[model samples]
Target: MIGRRLLVAAAAAGAGWVARAAWGTVPALGASRSAIRPYAAGSPRYRDNRFHNSEPSSSLPSGSQSGLAKAFLTRGATGRPRRAIPLAAPLAPTAAGELAVTWLGHATALIEIDGRRVLTDPVWSDRVSPSAVLGPARMHPMPMALEDLPTIDAVVVSHDHYDHLDQSTVVRLARTQSTIFVVPVGVGAHLRRWGVPADRVVELDWDESTEVAGLTLTCTEARHFSGRGLARDTTLWASWVIAGPRRTVFFGGDSGYTTRFADIGRRYGPFDVTLLPVGAYDERWPDIHMNPEEAVRVHLDVDGGLLIPIHWATFNLAFHPWDEPITRLLDAAADAGVTMSVPMVGQRIDGVRPPEQKPWWQGLA
Candidate 1:
């Protein structure tokens, strides 16, 4: 009876600690900002264009996006299914290694590439919603604490979606690490709103390249929209090409299938590792999010030596079974004879010698 009581007390204390971190009261990073970006408000990427400044229902301009159909695609997706979420921990830590990556669940990943630690879409909130009071709360605790992450080189933001561009997380990162922030154009506004130092923020357009702490960061193309409130297209959406001396990685921030993948391959092809989005897909809106099969095709298209599936298993932004993503992706990958790395949250896969990844989600219910 005494032991049971002590155990209960310990559990309560642990819960309290997690709650405090989730409330955004602590620093998650502590690195200096050396690769900050400088962009103007009147730049073409952030200029008021017809697609974005027009009606609420319209797709942003892109290579394949055109005409009346593009406008319709922007409105919304069909068959909006209800999605469930995991009760995730708010504090996840970076593992120890030469090149390590810890999945803070969902589309957020902490990557240590070429001796430089980087964060990609790091969202630690319980839910991915503008209004914290209403949305999908996590199903599991964050694997490690944000403060526990090591000094970072840069924080790469893919877009302004609630799931990717979380304000609270940004604030904490800003306070802790003088981390240089690399994001798509216009996303700098959101970071600025969150108290990020203007000198520490770098925003780029498609096909543009910048250098961050000896790493080459190229803002590549992606087929998606961006908006925090109803103001879509004010910000540009993108994937990224992170080139280190030892290896080059393609972060498929989020997008539907596009010929740009081939272009990226030609420009930054034969990536040692490709982190692609393989979930949150539907036939109704096939132009925005790529399904599992398309993700596999993109893996091959990028000429990736090893494929790592991200953007799933963290949040259920779309209506589908929680395991539907990994299941479909694995089957399709098997059919295509593609190699893959399916790491668990907080698990790191090395680029030079990444572990032989297994389908750890096999038993996930």
Candidate 2:
């Protein structure tokens, strides 16, 4: 009798574990590998059965497996802020023919240029992983809800990383907004699988351009990789150039510093503004993610007028202190004599006439 009862308890525990695993994967793993292969096969970067970076890169450092494991186990409140992160009440941008940017946080910004608007790498979900219940959760609440955003002309995604390309957010945007999704090659498969209308997805390779709402959107080069699971780099990664008739903006979705920025500047630059990533960086992955100083260099290489930093202050993806990226960025920009805007999350800055710099992050540190 005792043996039978123990066997029954073990079976029940196993069943419970299976149910949890299934629940965690719902609508998160995205499209299957077979679905993405058709478009992935055509690009030159998509050789070796995977995408390749222009320069060699790795997501993590070498000789650091034990160090990484120790760091993860002992993060100990060092990666977050002691005080609450400040939030700004975001204003709806409506003035036409004016250039502006409202940084929503962590590589997600709403760019209003000329008469149209473009949203970059929008991830509204609470966590950025294959499982919402088990991943890096947001340290601060989003100041503005997704439903409250003004009508967007286009939505641009830079890569297939979970943080940049969220399944739930894509589904919600499909249901709520009529905006088209302009993504790097092979990303359309995920959108289609998530029920986004096929007509609404525009897949572009590097150096490709498409006109939308009187603005020219161009996909450019970036040194990064992409994947949602064990199978890696099955899609392309890119920086973007969004040019209006009167103004141009560069969206450095997420990239390490590469010489291509100078080429991009000469080809389609002298941009009115540049939004570059300035967070979640470490020595181990220098080739994949740029540090704050490198971002300023990219801004200069692109002949950017105003530099508004992104990819920080939202999720704690790296081991650095929460405010370190922006803090170091301020010092570097001052040294470089580069004009920059460090807006509070959700704060809107007029691209033409940005306000004076304020160290809003000082107190939070």
Candidate 3:
């Protein structure tokens, strides 16, 4: 009896240690509940002590949680590529001319305009979850190492989702780079807690604009929710317009199709290029993520010159086949007479005149 009791205590102590390690290492929830209340006051979207989407949106459908879980476990397993994904060693941005974009997989990309580089939604972690030991791991290696990235003029964060805002990556950038971090309103709290200098962090609400390295960055509205933990919408989500003196580009962080694109086009139309999300969508949550066809429509609605699809090919967040998003996007672009570029993971695409469309993702299935 004594030996059995000792074994049970030892097992309990081991389980406690594992749980503590998993939960404690996640970055702090950043801002206290009281701190974010002030930002919510004047904002039109803020109501009843939480931020709401422009269109009534739901992350998951009613009574679909169980179905989603079962689908994910069964169908999600088939979403991975059967062969190794190719990676392109990024060319030096200095040689890519004034306006260019290098897709760094997932939603991360480096946009160079007028000699200044803006990194959008930079996530360099191996996994996109609170615990490193558990969660969705990368489908392919990063095209370029985080430390090897060229000096960036600015860093734009779309939202506070783990896949978008990685704490480990943020901490490293905070220590290594002097570049300014432009984020949605309440994400500044996370940066502050993660040791980013207050002066280096610039938080903006929708429709607000800030100047960084002689470029205009306007925060635009997006239909999504934000939270690193249980408390949701404490931070705002946004799309962005990056305009230089000579060229302009739009970065759609992650959003559903909305007429807001037309409004944006009227105010800041005819962009040289637009980076839009094109994956991780399902009918169950149609209002939150746009399908590939919808993405093309938003591109056209924005009066965009060149369309580059993002948010796919890096993580298996959805049950769709790995190549389906881009495949469907190609068909839609061909149908719409819209110019599109499907650069490899690290290939640099010229903003002014993108390379001819290539079926690079073929045979990798």
- Per-residue lDDT over 1-365 for candidate 2, one digit per residue giving the tens place of the 0 to 100 score: 99999999999988877676467575677777888989889898888788898878887776888998798779988778899999999988455448999989888899999979899999998888877466788888888999988899999999989889998888898899999999999999989988999999999999999998998999999999888888888889999999998999999999999998899999998999999999999888899899999999999999999999999889888889888998899899999999999999989999999998888898786
lDDT of 3 at 349: 93
**Can you give the lDDT of residue 17 in candidate 1?**
68
Judging by TM-score, tell me the better candidate of 1 and 2.
2
Candidate 3 residue-wise lDDT, 90-184, digit = tens: 98644435899999998999999998899999999888887766678899999888898888889999998889998888888877789999998
RMSD, each candidate, Å? 10.3, 2.5, 2.4
Q: Taking the tens digit of each residue's C-alpha lDDT, what string does model 1 give over 1-365?
A: 99999999999998886675455322221111211113334455444441121112224335533553564445342212233332323332443234555667777887777777778998887777754545555655678777877888888988878888777788888988888999887678667666788899888888888899888999988877776554456667889898888778888988888877888898888888789998877665577788999999898888987788888876655656667887888899999998887777767676668777665665555
TM-score of each: 0.77, 0.94, 0.93
Error (Å) of candidate 2 at residue 58 is 2.0
Question: Which candidate do you rate higher for lDDT, 1 or 2?
Answer: 2
Ranked candidates, highest lDDT first? 2, 3, 1
**Alpha-carbon local distance difference test for all models:** 0.72, 0.90, 0.87
